[model samples]
Target chain A: MDVYLPIAEVSVNAPLLLALGALVGFISGLFGIGGGFLMAPVLVFLGIPPAVAVASQANHVVASSTSSVLTYSKAGSVDYRMGGIMALGGAVGALFGVELFRLLRLLGQADLVVAVSYLLLLGSIGALTLKESLTTILARRRGEPARREPTRRPLWLYGLPFRVRFPRSGLYISAIPPLLLGVFAGILSAIMGVGGGFILVPAMVYILRMRAAVVVGTSLFQILITTAVTTVLQAGRNQTVDIVLSTLLMVGGVLGAQYGAKASARFRADEMRAALGLLILLVGLQMGLSLFLRPDDPFALAPGGAG
Target chain B: MMVPPGPPPMDPPALVAPAPEPPGPVVVTQTPTISAALTNSEIEVDSSYAGASLVLYGAVFNPGDDPVDVVLVVRGPERPVRLVRKVRVAGLWLNSRPVVFEGAPAFYVMASTRPLSEIAGFGVLRRMGVGLDHIQIDAPDEARTVNLYGVRDVVISRLGEDYLEWRRAVIRLKERDGLYRADPSGVRFVDPGLFRAEIVLPPEAPTGEYRTEVWLFQNGQAISVRRNTIQVRRVGVERWLHNFAFFQPWLYGLVSVLLAGFTGWAASRWFRRT
Candidate 1:
């Protein structure tokens, strides 16, 4: 059956969208990522306008992260104090990013900018993850100890003012770093149309030195707030959010995530990470190559001014 | 707004006193007349709407014994469209040289009993906008008005031949999406002086007012013409959602967030119990 999207003004196969959402959701659940990064690009490939795809997927992120945050809250793994500060910064950053997105959209460069940002960010992150995981797996197979980096806080991090305590994570750090991290993730979320969890998880682990148990929950908290802000701004200013499309995706994502979580238990951590890294690399590479490939039709059409 | 040239100005009122009537048998010739009506005047685009086929039945009167032909043209609402040509910039394809077409019809469909070329000459068809090739696509920003020779108010594009390429590109792309089409034999004569045509509106049809024109062709000239309108509108939940997003976007956004949050919460609760 076909479902017509009001905001996007496109009729798409309902089952196709549901399946796409499930596929992305399952991967995200297996790898413990937000999956917005995967969903946005695939939506564009399915012929949804890039702007609509980007904005609509942000709504999906809001739902998925909210669910994860609730689960984490139940287990008392969330550091609300830290997450609250980060969300404040993230909200402000999201406002700025949404305005920037609007400006790029008017200039007709939004598609290019979104595609290029995804390619660069995903490519580098995927390469690094793949290299790290491969090395760890090979070392274990050769009966060698996996290399580890010495844990040390940067001198500048301690010098910063406005120190705060996050009792749940057992960390007392300057609030400036966490706030800045949130702002960065928020900007990335708005521009790249992602939940920013892939970047946030590692940053929280290595930079903020937050405990692993608290990192995912706290990041989910930040994502829930940031993506919510982005979705509203995109809708109010750009009017690109398709509630119908987002609803379909959320339904599929939620269902798929449950099964994917169960399936994750069957795979080893290193092997799973390796698989995810390769998948991300391939998606990024495909997007990057399209930029240089000759298009079948050189003329592109838009409904409004100079687009 | 450019319109199909109307019937050559009704033979222009005679300026000089009419000459004394020549003595002869005054045989009155009947003028061909055409009228049409759509089966459904309004097409409602609900959630289940995929596409619609409209039946237009009409009749001809006083269509003298000159073997008259019927032609139907439907044009959807006009909107500004921009066509951008991608160019290689810094080793990447980027949009540039945008040509903006003002007042371009979002949908166009032409149907006739016979091939347009066989029914009328090129000049007549061009003047009447009877065929796909004759539909005027104006780009005001890229064009200028000038008087050429004795002709007044001729619009010419600044890009010269490049403008024609852009115009063709617009039609080509619109055709690919089934937005613009022409059928030489789409109109059928159900009976003497009675005719009907079927217009197929694809799922991507834009919502707005549509104008349908019926023309009576005789001796390779359009002797009679009639026009009617149809409306394509979003109805039911589709209309509500569209209006809500455009008019109350902030509230809609808030509602969207709340709905998603609730769904998420509910999903989590459901899984926990299992």
Candidate 2:
């Protein structure tokens, strides 16, 4: 059935939106990552304006983060102190990112900057995850102990300023690394139109040396606040958040993630990482194609200071 | 502040000469006067609205033996649209030129008994602002705003024929969306003096006042012109959302945040039991 999206000011196939939401939700649950990057591009492909697509996808992240945080918190897995400190740094970084975004827009290169950065970030993360998972699987097959996660602190991260203890993750480390990590991810979030959980989770585990179980909840907690801030700013300042569109997607997304969580346990670890690697590669390739390939129509339209 | 700039700009009685600007359709001076009305003057959109169509019926009166062609144009609200063109620079496609089309109609549909070009010559149509090719638009100063502050208005004057591509791109995008159409034979004469045309409005039609005009032509010159207006607006929840998004954006943003958070919590609660 066809329905009109109020904020988008466009009519779209209702079932198509629901199906996309469900699919993204399922994938996110299986991979334990917020799927804003995946969903936003698809929405833009389906004729939602890019600005609207990005804004609305952030709202969807808020919902998914909320659900995951609830579950993780109940299981006593979240590191609230770490998430809070990161959020403080994230807020400042996001401000700077927004300013940079405006400056880029004035230069007529904002879209290119966002697309290229997203491709690089996703491509590197995908390659790293695939390599690590493959190494772990090969070690298991070799009848050797799977390489243990880093128990010893890296020298630079240990010696940073603003040291603090996180009881939940059972760590006594300098707060500067996590805060700086949050700042970096926050800048990525603003430019790339994501909640930055994908980048944040890996940083927490490998860089800050946090426990993997606590990372999920902590990331969700951070994502919830960042995505909320994004929603408010996009709506208030940019006026691009389409509630009707997000509402439709969320209806399907919440349920799909639940089922996807149930389905994830049935899959093997190496196979799952391989699937995720493929998906990220696909998204990256799709974005990269527009940069390299000659477009069917070179002329595109944006709503701005028109004559 | 008290002294006037010049006497050349001032004109007497020209402003009030157009018959006191009626809120409804105004008629031009002629016996072959054309009048038209849309099937639905106000399209009320709700949550279930997909798209709609409007039937325009009107009559053109002429005592002479010559046949008079009637063309009806239903133009949606006008707004600004930015146009960007990609160019291959150093082995990669990069957006190079940026242009803006101010006062571009959100939607436009035209129907006539015969092709518009056949009914009138290019000069007449251009002056009357009828056909797509002859339509004129005003260029704004900020559209030429460059990242470099020094180069400003110089770019607009330099953007001569290059600007036409942007205009064409605008039309092409609108046509692809089914928002703009110039049908040659969309209108039909049921009999003498009576004509009708159908206009298809896509679901993406923006809510605003639309200008509906009927032009009567004789020997390729507009003899009589009539103008009317219709409205498109959202109702129910759609209306509420539209109002809130435009007026109280901050509150709407907060609502979105709360709703998203709530949905997440609710979904977890629902699924944990299963």
Candidate 3:
């Protein structure tokens, strides 16, 4: 069944919508990334108004992260102290990001901001991830052992107060890394309408040098808090949270995520990264092409931008 | 004096008896004479009715000897509301006196009562059918007439054994320079899952047979109403192209699928590690 939005006066195909949610969910589950980067572009391509699409993507992240967090907590992988500090910093960043978005919109530059941001971020991330994966694969093929280096905790972070010991990650790192990561995630989350899982996973593994086992759980915890706040903010301020659309997507995504997770375990880590990198590149190219192509006419009464 | 009176009375009585013999055999003759003839009246109308503009026309007929008055009535349901009303006749509004009324949803004609002798030459009383009812009045006597026109609120009455069933459908109308334009707008229920209703019209639709199918659904069971004709005609090239492009569903679906597949594939590849 299709549910219509009275305010937007738009009709969405429920099953197709759910499938989209599932695809995003699977990517998030497999890569330990919040699938927001993919969600915004897909929503626009599907003819959803850009503002509504971004807002709705943030809403979906709330659901996706909440579910993932529950699983992580059950496994005792979450760093509560670290997550708390990060969340506090993230809330501040989110508010600032939203204000910036509003300012850009007022200047009649929302579309330009969205397009530029997506192109720059996705292009850089895609190129970097592809390079790393290819280099790792080529190195492995040469039968040379991969180099492992211990990350040195910065002196300033250690000198700062609130030193936390995470037994699972086997580290006594300062709360500064998690805090900064949270703020960065929040800013990106607000702009991109994602839970910031994609950025968070890499930051934890490479920058913070957290154990692989703890990275997924820690990122999910941060995502849960950040996305929950984003959802409420979007609801209270913009009133863009659509319960019906979100529910339909969640129903499909939850099931699809389970299946994708099972399938992902069979693939090697490098293979998954390479696949994800290619996917991001393709989506970025499509978005770029849309700028030059004539857009399809939206058939609904009272389309966006009137307000 | 008595003898003179009796002579006079006798002379008068004799004359009176001769006169009273017969009241001139009362002649009751039945003549086969044409008292009145039913003359065919012509209905005339304008090119188009745009948003409550008055559609002007007249009914011309000759009533022999007897004076007759005509009453105009149109019938349709209150639902899917449309109202047509009468107004002043075109060109002769100042000189002619006419009756006006609220238009109805069905086919109706203008009639008037006047002596045939009074109707010298062509007696044309301009009539008006005005409203959103979209009732096209055919003026048979106009310089250019529309043979087939789009009709609104067409009630399809089903003749059942016990009770009558009625369903309302909009008729697509087109007309060209006094000719009938074939209508291709026919209703269809394309998607069963979504219960999406569509009206399909073809580009090459001519002044011929155009069937409409309205599927009635109750309790998830669909009953088909088939072979409903909506007359189409030549309204010119512009109208033909307009009708043709209205029902291109395949084009939309094709584009949607292609874009979706490409994006989905790209995203998967981009995010994947070697």
The lDDT for every candidate, in the order shown, is 0.79, 0.75, 0.47
Q: Candidate 2: list runs displaced more than 4 Å.
A: A99-107, A142-145, A305-307, B1-31, B140-158
The local distance difference test score of model 2 is 0.75
Off by over 4 Å in 1: A303-307, B1-29, B61-65, B141-161, B190-192
Pairs that clash in candidate 1:
none
Error of 1 at A262 (Å): 3.8
Best-to-worst order by TM-score is 2, 1, 3
Tell how far residue A280 is off in model 1, in angstroms.
1.6
Instruction: Report the lDDT tens digits of candidate 2 across residue range B196-253.
Output: 8887788877888998878777776666667778888899999999889979989998
Docking class of 1: acceptable
Off by over 4 Å in 3: A153-162, A288-305, B1-274
TM-score of chain B of each: 0.81, 0.81, 0.19
Give lDDT for model 1.
0.79
Candidate 3 CAPRI grade: incorrect
